[model samples]
Target: MSGCVFCRIVAGSVPSFQVVGEPSGVAFLDSRPVFRGHVLVVPRPHLETLTDLPEADLAGYFGLVRRVAAAVESGLDAGGTFVAMNNRVSQSVPHLHTHVVPRTKGDGLRGFFWPRTRYDDDGQAATYAARIGAAVAPPTRG
Candidate 1:
């Protein structure tokens, strides 16, 4: 946890293009995005993979993921979204982060071979973050 970058991001030590932060998890724009509005949702505490997440926390964590997926589609005016998680293989951060990528028709995203991209500048990343942040629904009171 001390050296994990995602933990630092959740702790607000690292500056990130944050979209949403909840009791369940925090969502932010991926610096190396597969698409313009690509977002990564990670648990507040350090968890290396999906299986590492506690069962009691699943609903809260995934509930946030669900909202972000929808927000990515609506905020970016995309047709749909691609939601995925990697355990160990290709798990860039070793944190239990879910990727919610905006998708549209004829986008040419062939398969697992994701073509990565970046924002022209920090302002562009912030703009995308704001859009998704605005579109994310408030957490339900239960």
Candidate 2:
């Protein structure tokens, strides 16, 4: 973690366009942005990927992500936002970071979600969503 660039940024060893900094993590503007006013939210502790981050820290990490997303939408007057986090694949940096990019109408990002596929039917889509919802539901104590 010592040599990681994101850790350096968090340590104040490197300059960054910081937006939000908390005990859990820091949200800063991406140096190489897909669009202007793009922000990257990174955990303070050096977690290489989503699976690497402890479950206890997920809430804090995602809290910053939500805040930064809202800021990107309101501050940039964007129509929407494209929030994403690439793991090992296509991940420029080794540290885990979420990209919250502001989106406008007709930005020509139609192909961003390449290889798009649709559900076989509405029922299939609903079933998938419901399965995911159930998977995330809090465990009930016996």
TM-score of each: 0.98, 0.77
| Cα RMSD to the true fold for all candidates | 0.7, 13.5
The digit string of per-residue lDDT tens for model 1 on 1-142 reads 8799999999999999999999999999999999999999999999998888999999999999999998998899999999999999999899999999999999989889899998999999999999999999987879
How much does candidate 1 score in TM-score? Answer: 0.98
lDDT of 2 by residue, 18-130 (tens): 77677768877666667666678899999899999999987877876876777677665779999998999989899999988778898766756522234455454444333
Cα misplacement distance, residue 91 of candidate 1 (Å):
0.5
The list of candidate 2 runs beyond 4 A from truth reads: 113-142
Model 1 weakest lDDT span, ten residues long: 133-142
Query: Which lDDT values do the candidates have, in the order given?
Result: 0.95, 0.72
Best by TM-score: 1
The local distance difference test score of model 1 is: 0.95
Scored by lDDT, the top model is 1
